[model samples]
Target: MTRTPEIAILGGGIGGLAAAAFLRRTGLPSTIYEQASELREIGAGLVMAPNVARLLRRLGVLEELAHHVVRLEIGWEFRRWQDGTVLSAENLAEACERLYGEHTYTARRSDLLAALRKSVPDDSVRLGKRCVAVIENGDRPALRFDDGEVAEADIVIGADGIHSVVRRVIADSIEATYSGLCAFRTLVPAEHAPEIARRNAHTLWLGPGHHLVHYPISAGKLINLVAIAPAGDYSVESWTARASIEEFLAEFDGWDPRLLDLIRAAETPGRWALLDRTPLRHWSRGPVTLLGDAAHPMFPFFGQGAAQAVEDAAVLAQCLAAQPDDPVNALQNYESLRIPRTTRLQEVSHGRSRINHLPDGPEQQARDKAFSDSDPLVDSAWIYEYDADTVPPFHIDTVAR
Candidate 1:
């Protein structure tokens, strides 16, 4: 009989916590090591698309998340930047539930994190432990932290973000290429926002070299806004970085007056540079593997970052539980099933950056026409219908157990 392997997950973000929660469901508990002193997420908004909603339901946190989220009756509403002409809109409340068996929702990033954190045991998380290096020591890989604490585990999963320490252990270091774009993110009290901004819809205004997206979150009490434009000289890549409202408005100088009014109502907007990294061909080495942004970081055009991380957590837990003793093989299986899907998403998201920022011309007109004709829910069926809990293990029969 094989013994259950000891698992150590780095980073206490959504991916890490979700991994722990899923593993617990399989009767395997893991520890999460986070760099920060507390487990919390920055103030931001994320689309809880059907794909993620399905997985969150399995984890039993979707109900708790529902309390803090705004269920979008309409989503992906595209409009012309200059005149606010409606290009396309999706009836998400009806179509999303009927087709995908889940409703599309939006919520504050912190609320989502808190919901995931609640599913994980408090003792499973170790705060203020910044991992500096990962050392391979035969079957037991060890993590070396900045505080000089060394710990070993039968398997180590890197749930850390883009700058993952464990990722360097398995893959060659690759420099991230700047996408030459930065985003201004802000939240407005729903009472102060424009009527359109307060609507239960996800709206995007597309134009030359930039685009802005906004939707109501926090159960319609707050409006979250994100505007992507040329980076210029700004290169900071932090969620907490500050930008004045004047700077934020300058980026969308000639946009519709309603959007400008919404921007003017923003308080303490955060600006961060958008960076893209080349996707890795492999994410597993020995007993260590990468998950979430550590494995495949992409542009936020698809709003699928958090969703992909949750998918990674669910699939990783499934693979590990299927082969508790042979952790290396299980890690490889996790990579095989995840890397291809995530790579496709990465490429598609990068391509969307160009589509969303096309200058006014025949090409942009054609793009708008395509949007008007295609239904987003139908087009994204492949993504929304995936169930991580039931996805077949990659080449499970071929691997010797």
Candidate 2:
């Protein structure tokens, strides 16, 4: 007889859905609780790198995601905002295959969510059941919902987001800081976008204290544009699920005309206050643990947020499945294995702005020259090439769902 874990996952977002699917694959009985009544798409588009694409492929959903997303020919295409000068380019297709053994993708968040949701067991996810708190019972965890309903599971996994309630309840000590950057994100039809941005590439334009990244998502039909401005200038919270392009355009009053054009093209955009938390010293307590943004919320600069979460799900399942009788050790080992690595990524993401904030002048000119002449990607092998299931030192503890 196979030993399976009775699991409860909070949040029906990508992390929760992916966790449920992977758990099912491991013969573990699990269910996910979401505050919303329906699993709806949130946000504009996301760049799902190879590390994430490989995981989705493992779950038999990459091809499905591809049908709805645009596969980038290049991983990153850095340029100058003043004059669209190509500084450097990283070939993701070859790099992803060489490193992670899969293709990278950029797609609408809704489309990817749909693909993951398809893999979820029917009625396994209880929508609109807001999780109020998690009470630990040494080796078993019980969850209390906002609707006066309660549930128990052998293990409680918090796939909730940065403001995760379970993360606060179990490992209630991790501190989150508002990244002084508020990102205004939107998706525009390629026809509505500038002719120059219709290709399948991650295009970035660096300006003074601010930058913008644009890419073709949904097979080049929709152009996903993101503008990162210093939060000091804006006085509001992140995307509130409703914002107009007109609102986003005001921020670029003196920006490049081309950039302004692209921003104007995106009909309405959703925005978010970029919040990040240091990697927790402990991810699991007793029979409870945290996953994804709820555990270590990293900056979006490297685009590793979702990828890291997916890796966490896979690793957690592997650890628990290996030692059924000792789930605590399994959870402990998972936390030990994952914390150091994710902490490193979180630290790296903290200093990640330097590369993008390339100071202009002789130094920036030299930087651009070097990037243009030599492949910067040669140095990024450690990042884009990691496998989800392979137990690298960094992943001895972390897993994706």
Candidate 3:
């Protein structure tokens, strides 16, 4: 415990940067390797529930992102797709804050990345390094970059995302599968959005075989739209793929006209296949471990993808800090603490598709009635109250070889 080990984090996205920031908070310095030439994020919105809000505040990420965030008073509005009628709503700003001690907020992904990047040391992130494979280096694990550069660290954290090379090394070779859905995303300026869409709330329209979610971000100056439709067998999962506005419109042909106006206002939108991976029985092997999507990639139904990743970073940093002398044991303990929670989340996120995309029949009527009858905040309160900082640490005994 006298000297900190050299920690290397792969992938410079939200999970990677957050891992660096969290480790730095615990006096553990780490280097982040990003495949991109520069540190940047795709234009998108991210929602942070109270569970992650406390961690972000502790890590100083919330303070840095305060200027760019839209604090949500009304959390979620589940609406009917045909008439845009409210199915259920959760009042988060007041109720959730009172219960969980933190309010939910939404911000652009770029803003979050910017804040997390600032917390990390300026020289900690190495750009233009694409990790090809994990190589053995006598006693330490080495990373082989696509550009033929090799780097070794005392410990490696794979935050490389769903297509992670590190996952191939640690997991059971479980492949990511398409979820028979595609999402078209766009950011509409506040001026372009209709009055109904200008509300400071997150709205979700659920219907047969499709759903739409939009929320205010960029401090209420922009609205982020994500329209998901059944894609059947089409399986290209690139985030930068462009889809015609006509194609987007055709998918929601029968939805509310007001919602159509929001879609029409987008100049251009990007589309990507919705994909997920089966939860692994293990997420760590000795000093090498996986974080974020690299460990568990889930459908977006629960909106916990990034939140869970942030949670993982906090827990992993704490576990390592607790067992500074035996990092392999620390990683095993981390995996033990995280796998159950993340596995449940993956199952719940996948299960939501059945609930959100039901046909208008007896079952759909019963579901809508149930939604209208109960508050979403109370139903899913467990998700917002988890605090990774105070999670009971695992009892470490034997170290992994």
Candidate 4:
């Protein structure tokens, strides 16, 4: 690895852009081939956990991101659905920074994407170059796009996403399994939302067979609301699918009045079926590897989807820079370092759904009692305190090819 590898990344999403930004730090540049004609994120909100913020600080985009995010003073508040009885709340403002070395915040998905995009050079991203196929030729891999263009590179990284086109080259196609649940997401104007919803706290209302979460985003200009319930027969999984406000309200009938008021404040909401996939045992083959959702697609119960993607970008960059001369071994090293952690998160996230949606009974009572006694920030210390930049890489006996 005397000369820097010619890196090519498929997908211009957060993971892809972050990878390119991090690689640039090590004197490696990558070209991103995106399927979309324009670069934009879906209209939603995401939690900027400490693990993500620490990396953004290193990437030199934390100040830019701060402009669009609402720093949480209090968060992880869980309440009973009927009377809004407080179950548990964490004082994130004081504990988060003191314990994790970074503060927790929430932001619009588009704003976060924009902040990451600023770190990458404009010319490096080639939009509308939808990758249709990935071909492996000896040590070099080539990507075929929809517009009849073929590009080859010393390394190919698949940040494409869950239905990634590049993944077929490394492993067999695995269908995404539906979790028999659906989520309704909407952005309520802060002016119309209740005082409780406008606060800088992430709140969750748990009830029998359903749960709802809400928090302010876009610098407190809007409140992001997510309601999860049984899917019944509906099973569409697109992010842009629409559902009426009335339909969204019907799902939470007979709940607390304050919760109902918050629902009434929302406009047309997007509804999507929740899907899960088994973690891949291997994510590298030759000079190509997968990142983010392209490697492990999990339920969103833990709100770690975006955080994990940023972590993957950091670790991948570190591995490649450490093993400069051997790109193949670098890719394998990245896979080995990342798989075990992400797989554990995937399982834990999937298990949280059942805990949050238990039927009202002795089991539910036991869960509530447990929640009241536990501190969320302390419980998640392992996830928050991880610094991918400083982590040492470990080797396995063999990596599947």
Worst ten-residue run, lDDT, model 2? 392-401
lDDT of 2 by residue, 1-401 (tens): 24566889999988888888888777776898899989966777888877778778889878677679787788678878777777777777677667557666788888888999988887798999898888776567888988899899888899988778888766556555667777888888899888778877888887666778888888788998887767764445444655667778776667668788888778778767666665688888777888888888887777777778888888887777766666677788777767777888888877866666665788678767777788655566666676757763233443432
Candidate 1 — which residues are off by over 4 angstroms? 397-401
Question: Could you give me the TM-score of model 3 versus the true structure?
Answer: 0.97
- Residue 125 alpha-carbon offset, candidate 1, angstroms: 1.0
Candidates, ranked, lDDT: 1, 4, 3, 2
Whole-model alpha-carbon lDDT for candidate 3: 0.87
Task: Give each model a TM-score.
Answer: 0.97, 0.91, 0.97, 0.97
Clashing pairs in 3: none
Collision count of model 4: 1
- Residues 332-398, candidate 4: write the lDDT tens digits: 8898889999999999988989999999999999999999999989998888998888876535554
- lDDT values of the candidates? 0.90, 0.78, 0.87, 0.90
Query: How well is each residue in 1-401 modelled by candidate 1, as lDDT tens digits?
Result: 17778899999988899899999998998999999999898858999898999889888888888778999998889999998999999988789989988998899988989999989888888999999999999899999999999999999999999788988988888998878999999899999999999999999999999999999999999999998999998889888899999998888999899999999988889998999899999899888999999999888898999999999999998898888878888888888899889999999999999999999999999999999999987988888888888887656553532
Evaluated at residue 122, the lDDT of candidate 2 is: 74
